[model samples]
Target: MDRRIFIKNTSLATAALALPKIDPLRSANLAKNNLPKWKGFNLLDFFSPNPKPVSKPTTEDHFRWMRDWGFDFVRIPIAYPYYLSIDRTKNITSEDVYKINPEAVDRIDSLVSMAHKYNMHVSLNLHRAPGYCVNAGFNEPYNLWKDNEAQKAFNFHWAMWAKRYKNVSSKKISFDLLNEPSMREDMNDQLSKRSAVPGEIYRKVAKAAAEAIRKENPRHLVIADGNNVGSTVIPEIIDLNIAQSCRGYNPGIISHYKAPWANKDPDHLPEPKWPGQVGNQYLSRAMLEEYYKPWIELTKKGVGVHCGECGAWNKTPHDVFIAWFSDVLSILSANNIGFALWNFVGDFGVIDSGRADVAYEDWQGHKLDRKLLNLLMKQ
Candidate 1:
């Protein structure tokens, strides 16, 4: 059956109050059935500093590349405010958010439809939500947790998506709700107590957003990212019956040695190498597992777990990234979890990760890293 027709006829979008509940047997079945082994890539261009209008043909080309490369889905990380105005000056009012940005809505529709055409899933993520972001020196004007206005904006954006794409198949479309919510001392430096904690605010805002989305369409497999850039701590919203997502970039010295946006002090960090000595200890799969143990425990608790984003920045050596990636992918697969690589075309992508040493294959006006591609395909 054609996937589009299948999605339409199945009425997969409408929902009852069936948010994920903790039933080990049921969750295990869901893991086998609903949760696909999503070998995916994040379409991150829309989240760039100066967001560009996405062309349909560009998205189609990307879908084709991903399908041809054995990937099954695309994780789209879009900044919502980019849709609010061309100049990005709109202070979205409660009444104004409901006034959907037609251009943005159409673009998302096109992206999702194209993914369905390729028989691929779409995990739509708000990398920059109304109230928070992991990027340095950037933040929304209002506090999402503390301010009713910001929470309304957050809920409004997601609810609009749920209602808009309510009929899309859960298999084909899911939500990654927010990007990495972290405790950054740099952002809003002297904020109030409640507003200061990232996890606490994330938890409240996520609950509200989840409730809003589910109200629109119940079965959306909403995914909430971990605190501190998808690291060790899972949010307290597990009881909300939503999926948990984590970042796989472990041993900062190796995975994020000198990542531009990372908050770590580069001067104090050791040089990175996979299975090489960082200090007295070697960075290996075992260490990665130790960091991942908490997230794995979440899966054991009957909520779906996915590594929503993971990849080495462009500066990391190609050989080292491949090795680290292999370990990360293997461990996630072994545990029956789905993961999406950070991107497909830019800094952290499989095709355009910008490794200085290798020759790149030009495809559809973009360069492809074939060696990395081969490594990814072999997995």
Candidate 2:
């Protein structure tokens, strides 16, 4: 199906504006439980700056906690480089890339099993694909969109995962094809125009990967993130029968205030306040609705919309963080969109996100933010 046609047909309908129900496919992994609105967190150990060994017991405990906390799913962002063999040279082919990373594969396999044990679904995302990653200064030797080998390697990686997880039900697991693909090297540039080039390239790559996975396991669900850090601007790839993912960090100043890594803030920017002024613009729920209009249109077309990543950075004041998160989650819930906060145990997590400014209590032997946790549970 042509993207133009999808946009034309989908834009005509209004958003469903309700949470997703459980899987209608009786045999699917999530058929019995539904999606639980997929309110969950991301497990980022593999992609963090300091990678740690995968501990089975620890992993199981995390899954257990997610289930106990009323969360439904977890997104595992795997850094592909961790699995690459140092002996291999740069710019390898798909076949070479596939055969080199057994350790990473084994680690993910164990985690996947743990998720199933606790009845928690998992989405495996290639945070660092063969040729592109959103991490700054960590440029791939080849351009993912222009390099033939990179494209082949990326598709092959998904195919490999499909074959490996062939028995896993689609409802239990999904493939978030790639992290955040953008047209320009710098991701934060002219987001609207940047969306066009990467949007088209991503469609081709995503469809190829989806086709490969479906060949091995037809029932597996595939998800693709939007350009510009999965912001609004959903590309017309829903025709591939895959779910669409976006980030929930709208009003960037509030979400990423003083966050250096994202570089979203400006010099001498005033303190970000929820529903307050950010320079000349007034940021509020109305703005959120306008930003999410594209995703709403997609959902009306029967496409599952998800916030694959969203949260306030630790640098933001705790009260402000809660306020911003509350508004974002409300917007998501009102529109029936599911989301996974940026992290599970890190700086943007429910448990021990290093926010000393907020009061915390011990729950299940973990330093838990009772207020934040309770708020999320209610949502």
Candidate 3:
């Protein structure tokens, strides 16, 4: 189970299978724009909407291991509230949003620097923006899409980050404007009915934010998450010259499975099976291909695309997760699109994933899912 032994065993097993090496030039030709198919993981050190501790800090070992294992990118999905000094007991006012805490900023700066130190491209994303979040938990003073105050604050925060990393090269860093843009009936209700942000409104907000960022550094790369919680492509923003981000968790039934946050009644959901029946619906790779058609077409239009987050929770059977995820990665990789797993060391990662069926190997005191790691390395 040691790291070296695991690698040795995996290498021999892979050789026995006689898998072909990925052709670099062929992969490069699949991409339409300058975007490289960056493959890596999302580090959740600052992902919680609440300021309190939710996840641990990412260490240098993560970067080193990822680089050693053949990954070149890391997406840091941050919740704005994590870095701002605000009274969590009350709704955050526009003024309260600007109370920037130097310590939190320093911690974030360190993360960006550490990722760069290992030659990893960092894509900074606002998972929870000033006025909006897909999940329900915190109270917002104003609506991002309907209120002027929230829009202003959203632009302000992006502008601040733009200025903060203005000196960094676009090749090494990019900004994912927001995490999953959607309109929910109630911002504080987790189960609130949700829909995509109106195309015009989404375009307006993205345009303004892109302008703010460009003002600081015109060469800085910018990306927008797909409308409707990262599922549907935003045709409205294609002309904005900004890239778009898509999700990997299509057909929530598979990706989410028994995740409480994803389903209202996780207990009642049918057991998941790849390319097989689950509940009344039959799921298959053909369905996945249909789902990603829009995203793949977006690439043909010369718009850069990336799967910012993808991975199933630990509850799903390990074999099913691998089967479904392999199809997801294959579809994306074939089109020259890249992906980042939801995390690197938690419930949806290669290390310490906590899946019941996985035969975990030990690596630097962490339980490494060698099978999952091998699957990821192949693409």
Candidate 4:
């Protein structure tokens, strides 16, 4: 066996979860099946993909791109203020309606339907979720896992979504449980006590979220982006018998390759900017394998995995990104892990930003990254 396969096979056997007392979302999940065929894509940051004011064509063109690109699905990450009342400001005092927004529901349905029109599969993800997220001000509110109310609210978000989309189909749609749940203590005691311990809360939250989403739809693939500090710790996820999934964000390395996000995060993380610091010795293949090991291990053992997002920032050198992507796509396809590039076009646009009417470059001399189309279409 090749080094990658040998190492991953060994790892999967070690990470299997002793059957938990809590019923798994899909009862059949316990029975072995072929790893789900996943050739999906992710669209984020570009449109906020959130409930925020969204342009219809913004999503329309994106769906078109996925079809043309030969990708089978698209995973969407969105932000919602479920903790607050629908007025968009009031903190939920004592109301169930306080937990979700119908507008978010409506808009998201629109996007899902659009994808369905294209015959593309979909995974709707809560990106900058109620209180849990990497963005500084949004650290989860209560003891995320242990708290009854918080778990209820968290579970409600998916339960409600599943109620709406459960009939969509495991073939056409899936729901990621949460985006990059992590253990960051940067919030200076702002988040409530129970949710305070990062690792513990996240685990509890994961179980609850998974159970709830599964409540409404057992077959849909509900993924939990690895619980590392935020996609950096797939190895840790393997320990949890958590499905192998990664957000594929290494700011200075790829997406932030050269754009100016280094100090962008509030003080807690002063991660550097573009072409920032991926070590010179780090060839794309090495990076892909290291990042991919967890997923490879899971799938070989009959556990399904997904690469939720992967794309470089348009600000960085496109050529460098194209070269890196060649290896990343090959690994994902080889392993049968579904992936979504970060966006179609907008801030990190693949089409809309720099090129104006053209599909490639938005600026002079910087032609569109010709490799992008080929990379996505690769089998």
Among these predictions, the greatest TM-score belongs to 3
Cα deviation at 343, candidate 2, in Å, is 0.8
Model 2 Cα lDDT, one tens digit per residue, 232-283: 5455576788887889888778887777766644456778877788778887
Model 4 residue 23 distance off true place after TM-score fit, in angstroms: 42
- Cα lDDT tens digits for candidate 3, 1-379: 8999999999999897897777987666464744789999999999886767555568999899999999999999999989988778787777998898888888899999999999999999999998888877777777899998899999999999999999999999999999998998887675889888999999999999999999999999999999999999999989988999999997788888889998899999998999899889999999998998888889989999999999999998989999999999998988889999999989999988888899999999999999989989999
Q: Candidate 1 — worst ten consecutive residues by lDDT sum?
A: 187-196
- 1-379: candidate 1 lDDT, tens digit per residue: 9999888766654433355457785445333313556778777656753446553224677788788888897888877765664434544444543455688668767777788899888888887777666663344566555678878888888998888878777888888888876655444442322222455666787889999988978987798877666775555776887887878788666667676455345556666788888777888888887877776677767777888888788877778887888888777776777778877877777665667966888876777888777766765
Give the per-residue lDDT digits (tens) of candidate 4, residues 67-161.
Answer: 77676777777665632334434332324334555655676677778889998887777775544554444334453434577567767777877
Please state the error at residue 291 of candidate 3 in Å. Answer: 1.0
Candidate 4 yields a Cα-based lDDT of 0.58
> Residue 66 of candidate 3: its Cα lDDT?
97
Roughly what TM-score does model 4 have, to 2 decimal places?
0.71
Of the two candidates 1 and 2, the one with more favorable TM-score, higher being better, is 2
User: Among all windows of ten consecutive residues in candidate 2, which has the lowest summed lDDT?
Assistant: 26-35
C-alpha lDDT of all candidate models, in order: 0.72, 0.74, 0.90, 0.58
For residue 257, what is the lDDT in candidate 4?
A: 46
Clashes of 4: 18
Quality of model 2 by C-alpha lDDT = 0.74
Misplaced by over 4 Å in model 1 are: 1-34, 54-58, 86-99, 136-139, 186-201, 233-235, 263-269, 279-281, 359-366
- Which regions of candidate 3 deviate over 4 angstroms? 1-33, 53-55
Q: CA lDDT of 322 in candidate 3?
A: 91
Superposition-based RMSD of candidate 4 using all C-alpha atoms, in angstroms? 11.6
